[model samples]
Target: MTTATLPARSDLGRPIILLMAVACGVIVANLYYAQTLIDVIGPQIGMSASVAGLITTLTQLGYGLGLFLIVPVADLFENRRIVLGSILVTVIGCLAIAASQGPTSFLVASILTGVGATGAQVLVPLASHLAAPEKQGRVVGTVMSGLLFGIMLARPVANFLAGSFGWRSTFLVSAAAMALIGIALLLACPQRRPRGGMRYGEALASTFAQLRQHRVVRMRAFYQSLMFAAFNLFWTAAPLALIRQFHLGHAGVGAFALAGAGGALVAPVAGWLADRRLTRPTSLAGLAGLSVGFLLADWTVAAGSLIGFTIMAVLIDAAVQLSQITGQKLIFSIDPDARGRINAAYMTVMFVVGALGSVIGSATYEAGGWSASAIAGAAIGGVATLGFLLFDRGASAPR
Candidate 1:
């Protein structure tokens, strides 16, 4: 898909961007709605603490697989059709989860939910494809703000809904909301078909080829993997810490998670920075902030300061979002034709590592408590920070 053959670069006005952002948020929320309900859902379903972590791990694992399997097809299919189909699958998964009678059924539905949630991934590259070259960063950032907000707010919203109704009811409600969003998207979003005549198998193969071909793709993936690991580590374990160490109930957990939603505000700023060609500095600051956030989380827990803990959560989330947007801005600029595959490779690595992080977080929290989880997060963040400082200086941003 050369520039000449590309779809007309239509204006991405505020309404379209807002619709895309909200749609992305609703779709991506499926992956995280289970996180805040782990404690409640685990016991009701007869899962052990260690095994309960799989609730999140499986969702992320399935999403990672979809990134490699489904997302690449965006380069070969009509974008709106793929997105609408994925939403229908998500509705089935959500309904299945609501009706599940045991852990086995619940886990299977969770995987499907994750796979279907790749619709959000589809929209992102679609948004990039629609925007003009000069405005891609801002457009991506705006859409990402919605995605990040969904992630940040899903926990609180799930916690609140589960508290009011039941854990199962949350899934049922999500299914209904997704159906509505699907209808809106179908009517509003324009059809975008890639110009290339590549087969599905070749499209998938070229994703790997891009990985082998681009140093920036590999480095950005590596860096983002570490940052995302720390991100998952903190979120997967923090609720447990709040419940166990801080002696908070579901309401308190929901409130704490709500405070962290403030971090999503950083998405636009990160995008603006990227638009100005400040990705390198933004990346470094993001890494450092992640490292400091973890350390501060440890201190807050020790001091028994709920306010401090909330602030730390905001800092950590901001850092992760900032790094992610910067990485995305870099990758998306590399090959317009391969944005789907590039994102697939980048997110596949990031989430695979993130799945591991969730497991480690659950294990460490069970064994050594909040301090262990915090230290583990800090260590991962430190590695990302060091890697960026030492290696990223030689890398050049795409013009």
Candidate 2:
């Protein structure tokens, strides 16, 4: 299908994409805010860096649980209500964090925040359902752009706020924003309820059964998990390295993170490529780039050169975003009816891997220094790159 023959904007227009994107961005951003504020929050609550990392770990863990368990409800019930409820839950979580007196409250709040922020996975599938077939890639891409922006920008924004005000203020502001957006979505979006009903057990059984039966889904999920494992490794160590090794302050480290956002801006271009039937090649290319980037980043970090590290940051992040878009495009192609469930399963696995990677990154960095962690991460990416190549062999050829 060519652009000339593409469906009308009414079927998948700028407005719809924009709204979906904003929703996705807002929801997804909630997950990463803790990353930026944790440095500040840790001292305030008397937590160590490793324990602080667990806050993110638990949030990710909660997100994984919510994705597999809660998101499936989108398939059984009306998404508008589910989404509204999720956002409300997020608001509550954020408020809890804002008002917390200690690390325990923050940890619980983080888990709830993760549970509530899963609205993005549901909304992405909803966009795919609403879009014309030929436009699914672009439509998904547009919404993902927002999601990527949220992921990429969350830390920087939180860092900015935390630096300017306090860590608690970040959650208070986020809570208010989530509440406002939840209200707006309730009023503005049209109802999209599930037409078919299935018992909770049936939904769980079917979701797993579908995963077992679908070769494409399994391969895409596996490949994405491996890729994200390495992605999280870098992010987990980035601030620690900057602040400890380079002697940069939180604000400076946050700026370094903001620079990484450059890579996510390519999300739309990745979508266009996938839509034009270049998804497989794009995936392979992205994986290869990520592997190479990891090696370069490892070298830069080991050498203690800020300029080299900065360039590596851009290349590595861009490569990660490209792989992410490619992975989602593949999953989105497999089944529309269960996109949310599929994504939930995929993300649950990946988040688990990511949490493990964060621990690995921190431990490696602390033990053997940046060189050891960077090299290990690069090696992991290389292994995943091989999977990307092999995975493409059995799939439909890219357009």
Candidate 3:
């Protein structure tokens, strides 16, 4: 069970970064397809609205578990094999969903899909590991643009598919895309397994211990967790408010989805900034934007203002995407050799926090109404923003 060691320099080129992004994008998109289609899924499966939220909850949980459990395998196995194997499993999960006849089956499929989709987390490390140290941010950012694009596009794509062929067929379409994407990755990506291997126990021990002891990892993990909590809170409640309060159709929600897509366009720029020694400012700015966005969301929710709410949503999406890239840049800077495990740990914590926020937001929205929920979300996000400002300022002073 020794871990294989890749060469000091991998044969990864710029084209590979682009290809990896596309492949990972398709894979990551699987986890969010349900987000847009829950309206269809809940009724079709006879689940309560509250319970239907579990689709996202369970998927996030599965993803977090996979990040902690499966992603660390990159330290032991070849990147191509790991990526291919995970894609194959993901395909199976997608088929399970397409064929499912009830909520229970689809729920199981969703969890499995999340586990398989963890390959994107592993790919993040592989791309960073392949690039030159000076170019890590740009490479990571390029790949993340694909990831964020997938995330932003998943909703609109799902809306289209659900509108056209019905919900189950959406799963089938994603399955087909996953298959083609997997083959492309198998064909294009270089093999990166090292000649010598470390024992599995040793590798796992090293990673787990690193997570426990690394100050930077701890700080980044907390930073990502808090930011993602805000992200989850907003997404979990926004659609319900749009549909129930405003009476907008799925298409309108899909259109609104584009704002986030537009905001995510900053991912590569954030990555470029991180590489150029602007990590602190980049992170702080993202957090500030998020805090302001949440406050705006709160104001609109209270005032029942549509235009203001939409603007707030766009700002929130942009800010969250920026924070995500900044966090990744910071994490990748730590212990470059353990990029896979580190990223896995980072994403696992973030998703777990997000899942928790989703649960809290949904409950608060249902019980106290959207205004209360908005206030709750803003308060949590406000604290995280303040923490980031303090951290950024500390980094500026002379030792």
Candidate 4:
């Protein structure tokens, strides 16, 4: 696919950006609605905690597969159609999930839902594609902040909706929200058609080739994998800790999750730094923050310090966003024409591992309660920090 820059005022206005952000938040929100609702969804559907991890794992697996299988198609086809079509699939998946009475159907729907959620990923590149070269980071970051809000708010919003109505209501609402969001995106966003020089088969093949050819793609993928893994671990386990350890009801969990969404606020700042060539230092800070955040959570969870737990939880959340924004900015700059494919390779690796995090989060908590989960999260974060520090050479950042 070839690249062309679009004007800021005509194509990339604040309204368009806002719509993109909202669309991204609502679309990606599908992946996370169940993270906090596992407690509620599992018991009603007859799934054990051991098996509950499959909920996130399957969803993430579907998303990873979509990143590799579907996202790169944007390089060959019209961007808007692919995005809207994915949203349609997401709506179907959400409705199926809402209607499911057993684990088999629900799990199947989870995969479908995850596949559909890649609309948000597609939008990330589309937003990047439309912006002028110098402002791509800021534009991408703004869109990403929407994604982060969806991730952060999905838990609380799902909890609140589920608390008032039922667990199924969350998905029902998500399906509806997506329908509206899809239409808004269709109407508001300018259509960008990639020059159709590459075939689907070649685009898919080149996506994999990006990982082998680009060190930045590989290293950034590895880095975000750790951040995402630890991120999934903490958020997945946190609701259980809140309910069992802190004795908070669904409302309380929703409130805490709402507060935690504050962590996503760092995304714009991360993007800004990335634009200014501060990605290297910001990357280090994010990883170190994750390690420290996990340790602090370890202490706070044991002591039943809600204030402390929230602080550390937000820290972990912010650190993950920090790393992600920087990593994405770096990777996107590797090849402007190949942003779609590079992003697919990077996210596929990161999210597949990240999916495992949910499994570990629930299983570890079940096995050893909050302590084991928190420590494991800390260890993962530390390893990421150390690996980056010891192994990363100075020239990895894009020149």
Candidate 5:
């Protein structure tokens, strides 16, 4: 694929973009639905506390694996078909989870859900492909805002559903929702077949090649990995902290999660900045905000002020979302033809680190409680801030 083969202008009107955004929200929500339900699902399914923590970790692990293995195939096949196929897998996974009777079955279903949820990744790069170069940042940002909101809201929605109807009902409803979204997307999404002539094997091989060849891809991926690790660490631990320290029930946790969704409002702003070629400065601010948010969270927790803690949650989520969009806009600009593979490489690394962050959050919470988790999160943010200042200070924006 070459520049000449690309569309002269974006075909992504507001309607299609809105549809893509909603689809992304529904698709990505699968990977997170179980996070807040761990306590409810684990006990009913006979899982011990220690093993229950693997619920979130395994889902993320499956997603990371799909990013490495399944996402690259987007470059070798019709993008819409791939997304629809992945959604079918998601439907099956959700049904299996709904029917699960034991820990083994439940965990396995969780993995499948995560793998199938890679459909969101497919839609993102597809959005980039359809948008004109100048509008790519704004379009991707808008779509990602949907995805981020899905992530932020999944916890509360899952909690609310579980509290009202039981955890199994949550999975059942998700399966039905996915099926409907898949049918609508199949009817509406424009078919985009990659012009690259690479075979599937070649496409997978080229992901590694892209990592080596594109310095911006590497830098952006590394920067976001650090921020994303902190993002996961905080979310994973925050619920536990609320339950243990504040005596919040599932409903209370759900309300807290809803408050965090406010941070997703930053996605379009970050995208706007990226379109204006302010990636470096915006990214630095995002990193600094992450550290400051965690520090404020630490203070709020110590003061036992829920309002202050919620405010910090908004800041933390906003900062992480900002950095994410900035990195994505930068990477998407590097190669139009390889957006699938580029996204695969970038997201694979970030989510892999994110999975570790979940595990670390659990372990640290068990070891030293909320203070430890906050400190660990702040330290991760500080590392990212230093990396940006020292190594990526003068990085050039993609033209």
Candidate 6:
């Protein structure tokens, strides 16, 4: 369990960072690989299409639970241990899902996979811990770009793999990946015992305490929550719109999703800007960009321009990453000693609120169409903009 102690310079300059980044991407991908496969995985496992949504829902819910419970443990334990242990759990979950022949078993495996995938969150704060203050934003940004890649690639990759092999093949591949990533991390990661003296109960209690104690945490969570809501909304509804309006099949939707991956290219740039202390203006631009992207998509969808919609997808995704990177850099700097707990609070609330976007996106698209979903997403962005302008900078802002 003991890792070799390396000097900070070589450690930070070395391959551990890349390992963590790739580890994060692969681990988080476990949460999503089954999302697109659920439709096919369902009937074989005796789950009806109507009830199949729970597969994705339970995974997300399990992720939420991990964000609330497991991520905070990073502050109190050796992070490498937490990271490796999480990988082990996810590998188990993936194997279980691959082998499951019943709906109950598959759903349980999905939840376990979701929970274990939160190792990505721990690795995120660990990136900051590993980097010097001046380099924290850059390091976090690089790693986050990997996380974004996982999110962007999971659906399309799942579809292609499931098509070629089978739905179970995706989970089997994920299990094998975790086994490899876990070994790499086990070898490469350094031992960083956290400085926390808090007990388990106090550490858990402090997650909420940190949110109430820090204005930056509250506002950052608020802004990111809205941005994430807009993100999930556009993504959830856009594919349905493509199918309903343009007659594009799953492959076309996958390609459209792939096109949005280009947006993750901004994550590093945003982080660099944050390192320059440009968070305020960068955040303003992100909010405005999101609103504009949604509006453009609205017009494009009405005009039946698939290319225009794709362009908006890239823009919307870029704006979301910009906002995310900016907020994350700021908040990670907020509480050095409690990065894990604060991050848990930040992400937990953000995702809880963000999940509503999917709900709203589905409802709006089914009820009123893509325009309504876009408008609703735009409204969420506009609200975040107003909050940033009106409240976030209200006299005592850190940035």
- By TM-score, the best candidate is 6
Off by over 4 Å in 1: 1-10, 38-54, 102-104, 366-368, 396-398
User: Whole-model lDDT for model 2 versus the true structure?
Assistant: 0.76
Tens digits of per-residue lDDT for model 6, 54-160: 99999998999999889998888888899899999999999999999998999999999999999999999988888887877778888898898889899999999
Over the stretch 227-325, how does candidate 1's per-residue lDDT look in tens digits?
A: 888887898789898998899987888788888888888887998888888888888889889989999999999999989999999999899888888
Worst 10 residues of 1 by lDDT: 1-10
The reply for model 2, stretches above 4 Å from the true place, is 1-9, 42-54, 102-104, 302-305, 396-399
Local accuracy by lDDT, each model: 0.86, 0.76, 0.77, 0.86, 0.86, 0.88
Q: Is candidate 5 or candidate 6 better by lDDT?
A: 6
How does candidate 2 fare on TM-score? 0.90
Candidate 3 lDDT by residue in tens digits, 233-332: 8877887788888788878877777665666667778778878878777777777777778777877867888788888887777677667777777777
Model 6's alpha-carbon lDDT is 0.88
- Using all chains and alpha carbons, the TM-scores for the candidates as numbered come to 0.92, 0.90, 0.88, 0.91, 0.93, 0.96
How far off is residue 379 in model 5, in Å? Answer: 1.5
Q: What C-alpha lDDT, on a 0 to 100 scale, does residue 141 get in candidate 3?
A: 82
- Kindly list the per-residue Cα lDDT of model 5 for residues 235-284, writing each as its tens digit: 88998988988899878888888898889888889888888888888898
Displacement of residue 65 (Cα, Å) in model 2 is 1.7
What would the TM-score be for candidate 4 when compared with the true structure?
0.91
Please give, for residues 1-399, the per-residue lDDT of candidate 2 as tens digits.
111122343555577678878888988899998876666788888788878887877888778878878877767777778888889889999999888878888899899999988888888777766677667677777788788778878988887788789877888888888877777777665556555456776776677665687776677766667777777788878778888889998678877877876776777777778888888777777778877887888777778888788888778777776777767777777765566667777777666776677778888888887777788777877887777666557653552
